[model samples]
Target: SELHEKVKLHYNNFKGDPKDVKEMKERIEIEDE
Candidate 1:
């Protein structure tokens, strides 16, 4: 569940940053493919 853990860490770091979360989401999606 590495991806899950990465998501959790991203959440922790992006708690108050929607911009960062969005960027991270895009990066994660790219990595997923």
Candidate 2:
């Protein structure tokens, strides 16, 4: 749950920037693997 919270915080930090959000999503996906 802590990881999820961290991810949420990251999302908030990247909010309103589609490019950053996309990069974040890619990073998360790689981490998931």
The 10-residue segment with the lowest total lDDT in model 2: 8-17
Best by TM-score: 2
lDDT tens string, model 2, 1-33? 579669868777775679879888888767766
Model 1 misplaced stretches (Cα beyond 4 Å): 4-14
Model 2 scores a C-alpha lDDT of 0.76
Global fold similarity of model 2 (TM-score): 0.57
Q: lDDT (0-100) at residue 17 of candidate 2?
A: 73
Task: Look at candidate 2 and tell me the lDDT of residue 18.
Answer: 90
Candidates' RMSD to native: 2.8, 2.5
Note the Cα lDDT for every prediction shown: 0.74, 0.76
